[model samples]
Target: MTDASDRLASVRAGLDRACRDAGRAETPLLVAISKTFDADAIRPLIAAGQRHFGENRVQEAQGKWPELLAETPEITLHLVGQLQSNKAADAVALFDVIHSVDRPSLVAALAKAQAAVGKRPVCYLQVNIGDEAQKGGCALADLPALLDQARTAGLNIVGLMCVPPADVEPAPYFALLAEHAKRLGLAGLSMGMSSDYETAALLGSTVVRVGSALFGSRA
Candidate 1:
């Protein structure tokens, strides 16, 4: 088994190579997806110079945040999954960036929670580029209204996020997100994952939330 240090080094090398291939800068922020692993596994990665991490479940993040922050105060936590409106307050309290703000209700909840917490939470409006009804994202046609609502609610709408259909090439989906960001005049696009990040970079993703590629397969 690869040790944490070895795994991190290898992942960095791969990221560097991918950036070069995509003709992007070499220092793109890498958010280590630490959803499944416990603190013991995560500590080594933090020690290995990883400062950004992502989680999928609000409940899981709630359990991990304090311990991880206590051990490494500089780590940035991103909530990268479907966020329930009920958990919005907790998510606001714990995460630095909420990358899956998919619905108007959730956006309103996050805005209220941010105000209650007295901290502005950076958010990404998730777009369902593939238009998969089962997925958790705002319909493409509704993005303008959603963005307008978020602005009125005083949430800092920083960028856009999306997950492509698993079976197809992720480039088109990534391109669609970039186009949406351009249309909205947003500065960030949190797209890509373990399998298709290179394509994402080529398509102008400012942030790539990668797992498995960094931490190995989740259990």
Candidate 2:
């Protein structure tokens, strides 16, 4: 089998095991992040039944996904990167899910964009779980406020998304996000990556964004 299929199979099997261990009857949605990789690189994964894909940039995804969407209209596209408030309209036009609603301005922008475009991509409030200064997520202290603002603005806030401090063990951060989700009664936790999906799954991630592992090292 081709490399992408082989890797996808591996991740699926691993996710299955993780769900079993966690006593969860359902596996989190596996969103293969196809940000920098082009169609040629992504086609194999699609051929192998990867229906959900994630991209971080508006222009980059705009440059590519239209034709792919035309080819496979059933595919679900996720915007899993930092979304600029101004690009809300562009993102709403293209993606099916937006995983970075972190601030009031973005919340307002997304609400307006959805009303104008007549398309409402599912939303997630990104929490700066690590409280890292350079990260794109809102500070942990601001999560509830952002959630309220996002919901009031009419963005369909489905759950919370986070990127923990790089190189840390990650479990604690994942658990923290889970705690927030549970407390808020939100059902989605968009966490984990190629390296830590198993742990995230075990801790109740309703969706996981995976890259590199399926597409191979971009480097």
Candidate 3:
């Protein structure tokens, strides 16, 4: 087996074990983050039966995925990075799920774009769980308002997402995100990454954006 295929199997096995250990009934969507690697590197995972993939940018995904997706139609694409209002149309047209809806203006742009393109991609509102200045999520205090805005603007909000402070124990943040989603009547929790996905699955993460753990270190 190729390296990507082997890693893919390992990640899948890990996910299965995590779900079993946590008594999670349904399998969380494992989004293979294919941000920098080209299609050549990604196809092995696809061939290994990885149907869900993630890309960090619309331009990069555009450069690589169109041809690949044409060849195989079942792949689900996720936009897992910060999206600009200007790129809303392109993002809505390309991705199946967007994991970075952070603010009201972005919500408005995405609503308009989805309407124009006639694609209602599932959205996850990013919460700045750690309140980092360099991050791109809405503040925790503002999430309710942002969610209301998204609903009023007619966006299909699937869940909440967050990047906990780096180098810290992410369990608390994951728990908090799950709790918030539950309180708001949301079902999905798009948290976790290569590092803490098992813990996230245990904490009710419906989507796990795994990258290096499955694809190896980026160049």
Candidate 4:
């Protein structure tokens, strides 16, 4: 079998076991992050039935995915990076799920874009769970109000997303994110990555973004 297929099987098995352990009846969607990887590298996973894919940059995604997407219409593209307001229209047109709705300005921009395009991609509010300065997420203190703003702006805020501070144990942060989502009446938690997806799944991550584990080292 192909390397991508082997890796995909391994990750799927791990996710299944994690869900069983957590007693979660629903399985988390595994988004194979193909940010730096090109279409040639991603085609194998698609051939192996990987429907969900993630990209970090809109320009890079535009550069490649259109042709690939025309070939496989079932593929779901997820924008798993910081989104600029100016790119909201392109983002709305290209992606199926956006995991970084962090601020009111962005919410308004996305709302306007969705209205103009008549396509509303599922959005998740990115929460700076660790309060890190370099991350692109709303402050924990600002999340409640941000949710209100997003709802008021007519964006479909399905859930919350976060990247915990790097190099630290992510369990606490994942748990905190789950609790935060639960408290806000949000159902989806877009947490976890190559290093700690199991923990995130056990804690209730509805969508896990995994990159290197599926595509090997990125360029």
Cα displacement (Å) at residue 36, model 3: 0.7
TM-score of every candidate: 0.94, 0.98, 0.97, 0.98
Off by over 4 Å in 2: none
| Tens digit per residue, CA lDDT, model 3, 130-158 | 88999999998898899999999989998
**By lDDT, highest first, what's the ranking?**
4, 2, 3, 1
Candidate 3 lands at a TM-score of 0.97
Worst 10 residues of 3 by lDDT: 1-10
Q: lDDT winner between 1 and 4, please give it.
A: 4
Better of 1 and 2 by TM-score: 2
Q: How large is the C-alpha RMSD of every model relative to the true structure? A: 1.6, 0.9, 1.0, 0.8
Please state the error at residue 96 of candidate 2 in Å. Answer: 0.5
Q: Of the pair 2 and 3, which is ahead by TM-score? A: 2
Q: What is candidate 4's lDDT per residue for 1-219, written digit by digit as tens?
A: 389899999999999999999998988999999998899999999999999999999999999999999999999999999999999999999999999999889999999999999998999999999998888999988999999999998888899999999899999999999898999999999999999999999999999999999999976
lDDT of 1: 0.85
Task: Give the top-scoring candidate (lDDT).
Answer: 4
What candidate 1 gets wrong by more than 4 Å, as runs, is none
lDDT of 2 at 165: 89
Could you give candidate 1's per-residue lDDT for residues 1-219 as a string of tens digits? 247778777766766777788778744567889999888878878888889999999899888779879878888899999999999989998999888988889978998898898888788999988999899898889999999999999988999999999989888788888888899999898988888776777677788887887777877
What's the distance in Å from true for residue 218, model 1? 1.9
lDDT of each: 0.85, 0.92, 0.91, 0.94
Q: What shift in Å separates residue 149 of candidate 1 from its native position after superposition?
A: 0.7
| lDDT pick, better of 3 and 4 | 4
